[model samples]
Target: MLNQIEAFQPLNGASRERYVEDLIFRFEANDTTSTEKKRAILMILCGPYAYVMIRSLLTYRPLNEVTFKEIASKIKEHLNPAT
Candidate 1:
């Protein structure tokens, strides 16, 4: 799992550490049966870094122009890209 994250690299130090910690905690818990719940947990765990990244992406855009579906799609693409 670390390998999966390391592939992305260049993350801010504090953010990266928090991400790693959260990843481990989630992996260990492994209790969620719903994909949506699991994904939400992961995103919440990402915290400020994920918040900042998504906010920047939606900058100058109205709330109606932004959607969790779009954010989820981007997250899925980034975290589980096809090789």
Candidate 2:
């Protein structure tokens, strides 16, 4: 997963790190509406290189103690209910 994420990258380390931090913080807060969470997740998943760094960090370490796969699966399920 990390390798798959890294393949899309050319991101600067600091910015990438910040994005990871922000993602973790948001996930932890759990204050956003389901719609908002789905939107953000969709934005990340839909983009090409834009979300690569964040995805790499997620695959590398669990955010807010939640597995990236779990969050991603949920988001995907939300987007595609029939799946």
Candidate 3:
């Protein structure tokens, strides 16, 4: 299934919105509704930096207890910080 879908590229030089949109498209294409599955896919495909950032962002919360939306929101807030 990963081979069929376009590979997730590194965040370098890419817009965060584009990166997130691509992830959502893949999730929809696979009919993924489970939060756990979404979080797994996101962490696995989002590269090491993002994985670490997510962990740091949710330091107080157990990773298993974190929601996909929370991870996504943190990524957005980090990548698109206001001036």
Candidate 4:
């Protein structure tokens, strides 16, 4: 699947909101299965710099300590202050 794409870079804050929407649209359009969806979502959440930031938030605890669900929840809360 990846070979067909020209390039896929990790997203940052500048247009991350739009990036997320686009990712969702692509995933849904492809009819991704639950497991594949979870894998793709994890890749987004665990970008190259994410572990360091998540660790700082957790005071340097082992990354295994935080489940992906917890990470996603924290991210959602951070992104949607009004919620």
Q: Each model's RMSD to truth, in Å? A: 7.9, 13.0, 2.5, 5.2
CA-lDDT, candidates in order: 0.51, 0.46, 0.75, 0.50
Worst 10 residues of 3 by lDDT: 1-10
How high is the lDDT of residue 47 in model 3?
68
Question: Which candidate comes out best when scored by TM-score?
Answer: 3
Highest lDDT among the candidates is held by which one? 3
Per-residue alpha-carbon lDDT of model 2 for 26-70, expressed as tens digits?
655655445555445535543566455345635755444554545
Clashing residue pairs in all predictions, respectively, total 0, 0, 0, 0
lDDT of 1 by residue, 1-83 (tens): 42243322325555444554555455556654555554455555455657666556557875345544565555545545689
> Model 2, poorest ten-residue lDDT window?
1-10
List TM-scores for all candidates, in order: 0.35, 0.32, 0.79, 0.43
User: Which of 2 and 4 is the better model by TM-score?
Assistant: 4
Give Cα distance to truth, residue 61, candidate 1, Å: 4.1
**Cα-based RMSD of candidate 4:** 5.2
Residue 22 displacement (Å), model 1: 13
In the range 1-83, model 4's lDDT, one tens digit per residue, is: 32122222335554444434454455566675565454456555455555454556667555455655565555555555673
